[model samples]
Target: MTLPTLTIGNKNYSSWSMRPWLALRWADIRFEEQIIPLGPRGLGPNPDILAVSPTGTVPVLELASGERIWDSVSICEWAHEQAPEAKLWPEVSIARALARSAVAEMHSGFSALRKALPMNIKRVKRDHSISAETQVQIDRFDALLQSLITRFGGGQASWIFGHPTIVDAFFAPIATRVRTYNVKVSAPVEAWCQTVFSDSAFRAWEAAARKETWIITETDEA
Candidate 1:
């Protein structure tokens, strides 16, 4: 059977797109990919894309059944349904809820961190000190991770559930952000980021992101 196709923005910088893309890939789900560059004056919308994603957003998921999933979280759910054996969520009930909460928090919170550490996979490394607002968000994120790891007995696992779950996908961008901005963080969080960056799947995504030519003006931090 033909698998669904995932449309995403530049791999290097599109945090939203990376969430589902990573989850799907890490799960070993077979699918095709379409890359959209988001920077200013990049490739305009394609006629084919305009038909699938009305908002013209990258990271739209097109199911084999011809259904369109526009948002990243929704795509995560869709993947879960398609590959139930993948165990994309936590197996335990409480861990599942906590995982969902973490994912949702990442979905809605951290505006400052998002603004300060816009993903640019190829950009030269440098520390942009966290702003007061960004620091607050960072602290909250740190507390959340610390608590989860403490509860779950962390080691090489991707997230609180002790495996790669939707929560990991949600925060993968934040992992990139923390490293990109060189934000001061506890050892555990830093270790988590290290694990994420070193993952082969993430490295593949980064490679593709660096190859993208699109340059959305809005995301240019330099």
Candidate 2:
């Protein structure tokens, strides 16, 4: 069978693309990645993306069977089923539930933070001030991450589940976001984000992102 293809946007700017890419990598799933350049968020639609993705989004996972899965969370779950050994979630039921909740919140919530602080690995702004609403979102995440770290990370695991999991993939870009904007967070979460930032895969992505010449000024406008 041919390897699946993961269509992604430019690495430095595409947080959603990074999610399932990292999850599939952790799953040990051999897949090809195609990088797509992004236009500004509100300019218009890209015909190139529309041609491949029904939803007109990047990060579409085209399977060997010709099935396409969009949405980062869905792609992570699909990859999880393909590689059970990855233990995409916690083995214990309760812990797994909590992990899913966290990941879901990351997937659907945090609009304030997402809007205020987009991911830009190449840019760092010291003392960035987020709005009170954004700060609330950050505080909420800090508390959530603290609880997860206390329960599963044990204060010192490179991953939140004490091992690589989809949850880590879900929040990996937030790691870049916090650092990019110099947002204050709890020690455990900060450390975990650093761990995510330090991974070989992340480093490769960042390296590639730096080399890309595609310019999306809106993503960097913050």
Q: Pick the candidate with the highest lDDT.
A: 2
Which pairs of residues collide in model 2?
none
Please give, for residues 76-102, the per-residue lDDT of candidate 1 as tens digits. 987888777778887889988988898
Across 16-127, the per-residue lDDT of candidate 2 in tens digits comes to: 9998988888889999999889875566678889888999998899998899997888999999899988898889999999999999999899999998998888898997
What are the RMSD figures for all models against the true structure?
A: 2.6, 1.4
- On a 0 to 1 TM-score scale, where does candidate 1 land against the true structure? 0.89
Candidate achieving the largest TM-score: 2
Report the C-alpha displacement of residue 145, candidate 1, in angstroms. Answer: 1.2
